[model samples]
Target: MSVYDDYEMTIGIECHVQLATKTKLFSPADNDARDAEPNTKTHQIDFGLPGMLPVLNKHAVELAVRAGKALNSPIAHVSRFDRKHYFYPDLPKGYQTSQMYNPIILAGYVDAPLEDGSLKRVRIDHAHMEEDAGKLTHHDGYSLVDLNRAGTPLIEIVSEPDMHSAEEAKAYVSELHKLMVYAGVTYGNLYHGNMRFDVNISVAKKGATELGKRAEIKNLNSFRSVERAAEYEFKRQVDILERGEEVVQETRGWNDDKQITISQRSKEDAQDYRYMPDPDIPPVVLTDEVIAGIQSKVPMLPGEYREKWSALNLDKSVINSLLSNQDYAQITLEVQEKSGEASAKRVAHWFASALTASDNDTNDDSTQTMLYAARGS
Candidate 1:
């Protein structure tokens, strides 16, 4: 065994992004699930009422299509929905409506630069649409189900195993969360249950040909806890291997208070989901015109926006800070539009420290929606 066994770690993260739609993806009912009249936001579709037809929210579709374009993925002209057979107290329907065999976005990449001055292009296997499960609220050691979020729109982003450390894994998740926030596709609030990550970790020898078995860290609620969970898992695996034990592929949970990952269950196989086309809904046929319309709505994406200001004469720290929070990019653009290129440079300088202190994406999706709609989307 080489020392690299302790140092070399491979990681891949799957992020669950909850889209910011005013209403449920397939129902016209308002989507204020967290704070609304109890069950008032829901409709027949969410309740799985018999013969209830699912009407695809065109806005949600447009947002999903826009996201696919931003990720530079090949859009599935005609996407299909499947039913993931599962039984949970939180799920009213026997199955979840999700995109599986035919996801709208396929094989994308997110550019995550490494510490070695080399850019790591994170391979995105797919970004698929799915309805969120209802929130489970536990009271007095018993759980109560809330269906408000049952039918909320969500997209799951699966990334390739391109990371080597827990920190890198955390960075990748942060980058994606920020991208979604900046794009106005998601709120990016991990605590609000708006974003979640299921992380995979494995170990390898210095010169081994085959990789070690993998363990998944499920439901890492916040970004801060992700690295700790991965570290504990890595140590657990290393100790098990040192004792001549095999690493079983299983799912674990991060105990943030205790700073460890406890085994939850053996990782389930794909067949467990029993994925099949949803018999109730037809295919989500995406027209070229609709695709083009959504594509046109994609403004200077995060990368493009950052590059546009990278060369500007500004403080390095300021540049880094602005790049971190995308509001800085929009603020710069606003400064430029209202004034000139020189003024835009000034805007970056002015917003650097102030924006860094706030520690949130100040910009919201409504600003873009109004701006884009005004441009005739």
Candidate 2:
């Protein structure tokens, strides 16, 4: 047996999902900064100017409610925001406004399906609402800060350390992404930083009762990166333990080009941030009726669609392809409802064929319209 077989790795993930709202979390600035000029989409609140106060976005809260249902988690009847104090070049206020003590999403679990048809259940600790900081662009000798992304709404989903393997980590993140997208909480665009993941991983002896010190890999945008980073970190930790050395608890950055993780800085604890309740914003209080109204708007999720399509006995690959796009899944279900199982099965195969032919470009508007036309016929 390999030396690596003697150790086990534990992984937990924290995802920052940008809310698909028209305006920033606290400001009236445009939230869609893609291809926009720097600083043009920012507002005074984003810049932290004097006399500026943050106003909570109601739509963001509604989206969070929908996200709660998607995760099988309960929403807090009353949630408050706290200021996480930190210093960074991109932070204009020198602190980030976030939900610390009372997060909006409570305990929940996700049953991620592995490739071998087995399920790995991962627990979610909580998810909190926060505002994103500005972007920093570095040059040879200087750095520029663009506040366009500052004050953008975000819900940070924190998962428990339940995942053991890198593949399990990848599956969990993939399932989480689908949940958010199908719930209409975020746009789920990885390229544009709509959903970013921070993986906290540690390794220990197989029979050890306690988990070893963990190093966090931050701001990974792709599911593959999460798996690769976890695998690399696990081996690195094992090597350290094998050499009679201690692994340092620090924050690391993934070098996608080099395919390695680089140490950024020592990870800070909660006391370091000196969390305090924000006076500018009031606590978010929701009634049962409000939550029911918001969550009722969440349409069918991926699992529901899978259960509905199981009766057709289509190939697993075809079902997976249909689930990749929300519109495709909705169209297939509509066809099933309108015509019959046979029609729905044929439409699903056609969509699968079309997706393969186009190389998985499901964003073609004209082509999507034609596919929707198939539902009617």
Highest lDDT, which number? 2
Ten residues in sequence with the least summed lDDT for candidate 1: 368-377
- Which candidate tops TM-score? 2
Which portions of model 1 miss their true places by more than 4 Å?
A: 1-7, 36-40, 114-117, 139-141, 313-316, 336-343, 359-377
Q: Give TM per candidate.
A: 0.87, 0.97
lDDT score of residue 92 within candidate 1? 78
Determine the backbone clash count of candidate 2. Answer: 0
What is candidate 1's local distance difference test score?
0.76
Clashes of each: 0, 0
Per-residue lDDT of 268-375 in model 1, one digit per residue for the tens? 888999999987778888778878877886766666765676657666567567666555566676666666667677666655644444454445575455334322
Residues 1-377 of candidate 2: C-alpha lDDT, one tens digit per residue: 99999999999999999999999999999999999999999998999899999889999999999999999999999999999998886878889999999999898988887888778999999999999999999999999999999999999999999999999999999989999999999999899999999999999999999999999999999999999999999999999999999999999999999889999999989899999999999999999999999999999998899889889998878987888888888989999998999999989988888677244545668676767577786
Question: What's the distance in Å from true for residue 114, model 2?
Answer: 0.8
User: How does residue 164 of candidate 2 score in lDDT?
Assistant: 96
Return the lDDT, model 1, position 313.
64
Model 2 misplacement above 4 A: 357-366
